[model samples]
Target chain A: MKKLFFYTTLALFFSACNKEEKQNYSNIAIYGHGGAGFESHTNRLPANSFKSIQKAIEVLNADGVEVDLQIDSNGTTWLFHDQFLEGKTSGNDCFGERSTSYIKTCNYNLGGKIFQLQELMDYFSSLSPKPKVSLQVELLDRCIDHSLLIEQLIAIMEVNNAYDWVQIESDSPGLLIQLKAASKHFQTFIRAPDLTSCINLCSENGFDGIIMNNTDVSVKDVERVQALGFKIALFGVASQAEIKSALKKHPNQIQCDNIELLHRIMKQ
Target chain B: MINKGTAFILSLFLFISCPTFGQDSLSSNIKITTHFGYEISNVGCYGNIGGQINYKKFGFGLAYILDYSDANGLDGPFGVATTLSFSPNHSDNKVINHFINLDYRITFHQRFCTFDCSQKYNKIQELNIGYGLSIKIFKRLSISNTINIGWYLEKSLSDRTGKTISESGSNSLINAKLNYLIAK
Candidate 1:
């Protein structure tokens, strides 16, 4: 019993540290995941928040920020990415399906406050025109009422006068097309499912740009898409080496978990 | 790489069983051992069922760990699976035995992840050399405890958004396992 207790204690001791893995730094201008915050994965800083976005711009100097948007049953859209709040937050599995009032009470570690979409848009619109931070928002199809989601989304963007600053991206072609049809002024970027589709979608005239996963398409593909006269962004880069490889494409934007390290590497 | 890995394993087996060649006092026994244990560095808890063929002072072991379930009872641990073991039973003493365990595990980890909420297991192969003590509680039933110095090789496909990627790394850990043995 003593030995078992000792081993368990030792295991707990190691777990409590939960040290963030170190990556070799590089200099790169990219989209910051959850706003370039540290200790956020296990809920130190909430991803897709006002504070995280500000941190991304001021601290990491990210040119643009990508945030995830999901709606609750109360028709209130939130700045959360995952299908389940339990994934990163200290919330339970069914937390995603719960009412907004219940969600507001739950604590998400260091992601202290949850900001809804209208408020986030209001905050950004309040900012002055100088040194404006580009915003790329991804829609979570599963989290909201499917039929009314796009309608409500368009309403908020139009109301906040955020059309010029926002570039919306999603894997759902239906949503992308719907957003384009609903608001001709708003920028819509199609998140191509693969390289073939990336080329195919970029070839079409509707989208302002194409976003591809770093692993799916290479530098050559990026060049091909750019030749078709479409802007390109590469996301889902988890390491410094991946950032280095993706930078070879010279993409218009790249999403990275460690932008500070990337900038440092670039400075070197 | 697969061929080279297979070759190394074959060589290891031949080396482990070399001492029993042409020996007559060697006895053959079959053992089933269940291992319910946890791995450190937040690797999670795992349950393993091992089969071994004992010949005199040596035994070759194979174990399958069930770690894929979403619900793992109490702690809900996400652990790793699959291992190979070699037991060098005591020829000099009756109280203890020496062991060299070669483990091939699909380790589900957050550390070596792509930062996505959903994660998959990466391949981890480890070799642990340790000493074990066995207590025969009843007929055909015994319990054993082993403490090992482990060296591991990690090679697996990454959870990529667009394409699958191969990743590799290495680490060392100190581990212990408590196993319940049923023999025939």
Candidate 2:
């Protein structure tokens, strides 16, 4: 009877080990840009509102997705593209004035205001696939209080336990370096518009990789970056042709407005 | 050169509207496919061996074929072709695959003299859509029964004909393919 019990326990232990192994590996990560920006003109994506964004995230979970974020000058992080809430919101033309109070008072045309950084993080944590998907926060504010913004953002993400699945990024070299130093845990990257600058940034700082417009980059450029043992993050590409072009570059991650298109191009 | 407006519109349609045949996912793997089949034409019947390597949906490959006809005896052509297939994933074998293919073949033909003093021969420039069945023979190979709806544009030089003769037809071909899976 004791031998039987021991054998049963051993079988159960191996079964538990198999379960852990199953969760450790997954190949696909589908990236979705916030609400289908310019990719929608041809993609004809659904409405670009909060509900659509949430739904898009859910659809992305079925295949894995990466969300975008940016911080404002007032030390508040929000889900937005531009640095200012001017023409996008009330057309006030107030650039660099990203205060939540000012943004709240104005009437946004879409009937929904910007999502607070905490609120966005909370939404992801509440999802079924909480940390499987990741985040790429683009530091949009040029004049942000880097230390304060990084502290508060880290506090929020830490509280929600999202640092495990998020990476902080920016277009400014100095800002990205500062943010990385402050966080210490999350990976950091620089978003450059040109390939030469991207290569220089990645090599100079020993960054994880660089994200750039797909059309602006060439295969040789991407190959050079990859040859350096650094990763390549591509963005703003939404078609099969563009994906095929980007693949020649051998990107580490490709962020697109159309996740379906990414899957198609990659599958081939 | 085509007008900018027309080119722009056509490019826009090709860019945004083209749907891939498979599921979209992020996995870095290369697919290698090889095919062998027979071809029949007015000149003769030919056996061909072709292979292709597709990396992230773009294909580069070569084909070598031998032809034997009642009129022409035996002739061979070495051809090279590329495929641009847009799709999400091929996990689910599809019956109709939408793809654009460019094929060039260098073969021997009787050069005819056109009435306009132009040259003509039996050369085909084919742009085709693959519509058919993909059957998995085992784990390593797939046999495809496909019909290609293509535009066959021929350039000829003869006293009675012009420089170019075009025809649209459905060509039936069977492809026996060997597939290697490199990624998920």
lDDT of 1: 0.55
User: Model 1: residues >4 Å from true position, as ranges?
Assistant: A1-29, A37-43, A93-96, A129-143, B1-184
Q: Positional deviation of A70 in candidate 1, in angstroms?
A: 0.4
The TM-scores of all predictions, comma-separated, are: 0.50, 0.46
lDDT of 2 by residue, A1-268 (tens): 5744554455455434422212211232445665433322122222233443553443222232445555555766665555555655673644335566765565555445666657666666665445333455544556556566667766776787665676666676776676566565656667776777777887777667677788877778777877887767777666556755665666677666654344433432
Tens digit of per-residue lDDT, candidate 1, span A133-216: 334444444545766667778888788777777778777777777877887887877875776775566456387778778888
Q: Candidates' lDDT values, in order?
A: 0.55, 0.50
- TM-score for the first chain in candidate 1 comes to 0.79
Q: Write the per-residue lDDT of candidate 2 for residues B1-184, one digit (tens) a residue.
A: 4322233233323322232224255234555555665554322244555555566645555655444322122222223334344433444355433334444344433332213444323454445455444566656566654444443333333223232433223232333344333223
DockQ of each: 0.02, 0.01
lDDT of 1 by residue, B21-57 (tens): 4545443444344443434321223444444555455
